[model samples]
Target: MDRRRLTARALAELADVTVVSLSQIKTGKQVPQETTVQRIAGALDYPVAFFHGADVDTLPAAAVSFRSLSSVTQRERKAAIAAGGIAYLVADWLHSKYTLPSPKLIDAGAERDPATAARALRQAWGLGEKPISNLIKLLEAKGIRVFSLAENTKNVDAFSCWRNDEPYIFLNTFKTTERSRFDAAHELGHLILHKHGGSNQGPQAESEANSFASSFLMPRADVLSEMPRVQSLQQILRGKKRWGVSAAALTYRLHKIGLITDWQYRNFNIQLRTDYGSSEPDSMQRETSTLWKMVLDDLWDQKLTRADIATGLNIPHGELENLLFGLTAASDRPPLRNDRPALSVV
Candidate 1:
């Protein structure tokens, strides 16, 4: 509640009490009746005695520590951290119920270091030097729900949230195709690499995710061969179809791999910005979630959907609707009945 910025006066109104009474309670000047306390607790969605406690349970102790220096600005960094923290809390709390399917996430356990993470993921998908043909289909196959966010943001792009142990990534469909692909891959990096290990948001973490996406989407072994001939914008534009990565991502990849000179990278970026790329990803204009396609066949195989999900958990349809959509709330969970397939929650 405190981290969420619920003030005393606001709490009073939520509790249906006078500001004076609220202040009295805050200052320890008066003891509120049991009924009043209950109302306050209900309105605040917290335990009845929470207001008087020094340490609130809503915010975790680990989250209370001071933050590190950010890769972006302090202000934007703070917002990003809050966004991650909120999502993590929501994801954790919501996962307690219902068996969640283990996503086709490749665990880089033996190769836990960064160098191995990329290849581990690539090999896990049977992607031997294969260029990613489509971001939408690839992610959908891995149990990632793709949605287009209406709001446009700067210094920040796409993001994924795990609610009810289900991973959903939202792309800012407003961005150009080139940028959109980068954002999608970046979000996938979040899911694969950072979703678990207490990773925080900021320019630095964002950079880490971005780099992973670039490497994951276009492996150096496969794409570096053409770096010498990638001088003209036409070369990159043509390469975009096969890679499903933006010109920017490819250009950055070239720079990272030392294929293109720093000056060349900067110049090409200028050209890309001037052209502004082309249309958004096919579904971006419509702004819909496409995750249902790839995993549906699997879910059907396992007999899981709204009906099966509700039946397994003993929750109602109306409640299931809320769980499926955002109308109501439910917990996130790891696969409950392991009698079937694979998945994980972090």
Candidate 2:
């Protein structure tokens, strides 16, 4: 159900079984026969061995900090959470083989405002109010396991949560590069501000996260020094590349920091809506996971195909590729020589 995003009724239909029988099997009230099990596996496109693996723990809906919870459907939400579960398994496997960075995030639950919390984190990390060159790489450097949400729906933009001692972030790659970067920072806000204990969902939390992402991505001091006063939408469109954010995001940040007047803000927003509605013009290049790339390269050296990894984890090769920002699909290229030293995760 989790892997294929199928409901009981849907699975029953696919497997040619009655809903009552499927429900009974799911509840452990009745055991499925071998033929039924095979039919179910075939219907879901999962190997039968996948069912025999140890129970995989899924992220509870409550613990996840979804960016647009109000807009996401229940099935989309469930599928996203299930993706997190697969990510956890893959992360564990990577940890066993390599030493990833330790978590450097601070708990800012007590912070009065998201901007202050963002500043504290930046100072702690020695970022010094500069634009983040690569938000995905920075997150991985700080020991955040970043994964791509491969669901075809746009409703689930991004989500983040702490799994035991490790932090994980899932991003929807379907979005424009700039919006995706902001989503990454927004999830970082949830990880930092709501880590200890707080409502990481709902409008208030979403607003705080947006503020944190604004501050974290385009620091107030940096923006002031770079562009003290915004004049036109074209100027904003040009300057937005400096912070790797969309024109809309940069416009909001400028208004929030008083660099732009309310009148200007409203005008720019109207112009932006007119020009590019729900889309970014001249979008930045989408960010991919550096850590996963290095991992795959190392595995390629050992002649370990993505299929092998997926088989070991009891998941489909496509699912593994989906989680990895489609990095594994590149494995179809000519194999590399196994002459390099073992990869040391930095």
* Winning candidate number (lDDT): 2
Tens digits of per-residue lDDT, candidate 2, 187-276, equal 999998887757898888999999999999999999999998678888999889999999988998889888899999999999998988
Which 10-residue window of candidate 2 scores lowest in summed lDDT? 332-341
- Scored against the true structure, residue 199 in model 1 reaches a CA lDDT of 56
Quote the lDDT for 45 in model 2: 89
TM-score, model 1 to reference: 0.54
Error of 1 at 53 (Å): 27
Per-residue error for 196 in candidate 1, Å, reads 4.2
124 Cα displacement, candidate 1 (Å): 0.8
Candidate 1 C-alpha error for residue 255, in Å = 1.5
Tell me the lDDT of candidate 2.
Answer: 0.88
Cα-based lDDT at residue 198, candidate 1: 53
Over 4 Å off, model 1 = 1-101, 109-115, 161-166, 226-228, 274-288, 292-346
Q: Show pairs that collide, candidate 2.
A: none
